[model samples]
Target: MAEQFNFSSPPFDLLRAAERERLSEALSVGYYAAGETLIAAGSAVPCLFVVLKGVIEERGEDGKLFAQYTSDDIFDIRGLFSGSSKHVYCAVEESITYELPASVFHQLCGANPDFGRFFQADLAAKRQLARRDGQNLAEFILTRIAREHLLPAIEVSAGLALGDAARLQLSRGADALLVRQDGELGIVTRTDLMTAHFRDGRSEAEPIGPLAHGPLACVELGDFLFDAMILMTRKRIERVAVREDGEVVGLLHLTQVLSLFSTHSHVLAMRIARAESEEELRGAAETLHTLIATLCGNGIRLRFIMQLVSALNEQLLERLFELLVPPALRSRCCLLVMGSEGRGEQLLKTDQDNALILAEDLPVEQGLALMQRFSEALLSFGYPPCPGGVMASQPAWCKPLAAWQRELNQTQLEGQPEQLMRMSILADASPVAGNRQLYEGLRQGLLRFAQEGERWLPDMAAAALQFDTPLTILGNLKTREEHLDIKRGGIFPLVHGCRVLALREGLEERGTLARLGALKARGVLDEGLADNLAESFELFLQLRLQQQLGGARDGREHGLDVARLSRHERDLLRFGLHAVKKFKQSLAWQFHLESR
Candidate 1:
């Protein structure tokens, strides 16, 4: 028997330990001299080849470079299984490969479904499997939350006196107590008990039910800790009751959840909120890359990761505004995060697209100065200045409520290309802090303009169709400079198409997926189409994030290197581009853009 094969890479990594041992026993080492033809095009593949040393070059029928396989790389699985090789595999250098015989491969496939599926699965299926594998990793936060991590629910009868309940809780070392009252359960935290006793001047003899809060926030024992953290953040509650089969099993405290993830978004959000100075906020912002890498590496769904990043970014912006602007000034203006940040789709810290909507009758100079300081502080805190000057620091964007409304009306009426772009940016604007009423007034005006100018939607939607989807008729990517612009080709169509639909339907949502859902709910789009668009948009986002994380030069222009993607990923990209084409055609038909 040869040395044991390393099962640390994909496809092989999907195999079980026993299966790896079987494979290790069955595989035989083979060597090829440079330029030797290993597998000829149009010929049958005898076995799967796993490169052990040196490199193999795969060439098409025309002798074009198709792909390269190096150490630890597997090749010809598809050809071996299908019984027909599509490309010529030749050793580019003196190469050694561990060959798994066709019989053993067939036996393994028959024995292990997962191992078989890993080679045959489509990109989406492979992505799901990868996510499952990530979930199984020891470092993923969700994997850390076990049965032992949950604190047992300490219950007390509602009729019991507060003093007795406190003593019982203390004896049990419980941070909270579940009180049973009128055949229903309520939660009373230690803080609640203390507040009841110290602030409300409640007597020890008083019934504990009066201090209990219900209906309590509850989560299932099997729920992911990430979900629990989101719930806690949304509810602004410190504790959630854990239940199983309609029975209270335990209580999950925020502290315990935090303990499971030290560098998680929630902790970073907390740090951002607590930062007293620009330097402290900078420290928190600095951890964003690590957080993103960890989450992405763990295969967390890109959409959820974007939402978490958006939330943390919002906190950072809000904290920066608080630290920069005086209370009186802050209250008078609504700080709006524009563009991707405004839409809650931004994954990385990009440019700062923000505006300050001041209340009527405020001095423009004072507002400008405050905004300048705020924008400068954000720049210091890691947000780059907007290239188009779409920032609070700009006098044009830092405007009073009436001015904003007037500008919206002007842009809607004019409908010029630049004005349309401006309107689109404003359409996705979401307020991060300050006066909500002012922001709402501006939003209502914008919506009203959209209603009045429904004819302009065709033109707005036309932008989505500007760039041809970079997909060939053969279902391969048509690339310029070996790269396909994922953003302009795929993301823009879905995002702008959703935006136009949202505006026409009077939807208030800013996020592309949310707007799609709203459009579906409003009968503007069917469930199937909406779902396809959502998945397509998500795929585009994931690819774009991967490209950014991969350190592509000028991410806005260069896009994703199509050649660098895995075979399944390329297939997924093609599928996503087809979705974009469908969306574009839908937009054209719906808006009657073709007639224009």
Candidate 2:
């Protein structure tokens, strides 16, 4: 019997030698006839059921089929801890199942903490575990360059004597050292050092400036480890600088990549970071959907995928800004990305939401050419234009820092409904390049104004409840026009609700998940609600991304294509919407919008 049962299967496989022996000895096989209820609603869950044959159907009290378990699929583990089942589990056909008694299952869970957490973990954790369910090695999608060890970057002033630079490089024990001049970054390698003296015949006392290579090749820290190897091979360079937030932070050597992975060229971040021209950046941006599909298909979690995409987008936008904006004006203004892009939740190349902030009283004439080209370049890259005119090209969004602060303060103080929409959009603004200090000063002032405004929160929060959820009377999803507009129903309410709560509590975080965590930490929200909201938010992102990628090539708008989803998917969608409804209800109570 021990040999017949798949001890190698998950959950069972997680059991060790002693635990396996205990499980094998205690395991018993049971049979159920078709149409017979295995577990009744509200009944105490008896034991774990791992199907050996036939199908099992799980239905709610309304008799709506929520799921079907067949083959090796397990049913209702959470029912044990909760002590009662909320759904009826009935055999769809005659079945044979491996039953592990409640006591033995509990013992195994206690013995293996990893196995325990698999059931107790949050939705994200469960997704990760499920991705690794039967696997030995982690999925390739999780192999990020940032997780790999990066060699520290050594830097020397451009005017440093060749001998001094060489000594500095040697002291740091690096193959190369970075050189900075006039806000430009370049690299001077040890081999280049020898080439300078021997090939160019320059004295050791000469400055290393002329020997430095301009526009050094780069890859962002969030890039795939697999892509980094491809970049090294294609460029024929031994290493590439790693960028974070538009700044070079470390080095990724070919030797390091060689030890980790072989060549594969789906390198969006690497291509964007190493791009020399606007055309090159455009080519890189075109591959964004392919990369998203690859990562999502490989079982990478949605939030992690969003983080990687956001970092890559930032690197691309920063390089594009450097190309169009003149050197003289670069330090006097800050380039911003707002809305979904700023929130770090954007999964696909959507509408352009951006703005610019100039230093106080600084002339915009120096970079006026920049304002339109930035938007045009993005449009050329397949990013749709913001119909609401939220882009930097709009004069209303592009303003001086003092002007921005004053407008934000006036909006908050006046408490106008029309103005609150602008306030909400800016709540998630983030600076990706130029002098970030300009944006920082503007943001700090905005937060101060919101904190003091008495009616700001309720008015803003009231907007979250304006759209009713797309759930039926029995808490099932109700679709409109053959599909559900998940954005209006689930995504917006969760995002804006979390934003208002975060602001009311004075949290500076921008991402919804980050805000939810902060709110929980500050005791504004309980752990259960926080986890539920986070899980639900991620679920919406995953669903939205799934449909977006499916329609990318066809240029169709994205949503949960209700007519095409599987029963399990539909149930998951319902579960996620319920969580969203719960969150919105809480917001209504907290912000005193219950009457409205």
Best by lDDT: 1
lDDT of 1: 0.80
Q: Itemize residue pairs with steric clashes in candidate 2.
A: none
Choose the strongest candidate by TM-score: 1
TM-score of every model?
0.75, 0.70
Please give, for residues 95-179, the per-residue lDDT of candidate 2 as tens digits.
9888888888888888888777766765555544434422211244346777346877877788899988888777878889899
Q: Write the per-residue lDDT of candidate 1 for residues 1-596, one digit (tens) a residue.
A: 25856665556667777888888888899889999999999998878898889989888899888667776667897798888899999998999998998888988888888778877765455555545443532244445345776887988888888888889888999998998888888888888888888999999999998888888888887777876776776555788888888988888888887776655566677788789988998999888878887777667777767777777777778888888888887778889998889999887777889988998867888888988888887777667888999998889899899988888787767778887888888998999888777899888888897788777778888998888888765345789988887888888888889998888888889999899889889878877678777877888777777777778322244378877776446657776788778778888899888875
Q: How many pairs in model 1 have backbone atoms within 3 A of each other, for residues 3 or more apart or on separate chains, i.e. clashes?
A: 0
Deviation (Å) of 404 in candidate 1? 2.8
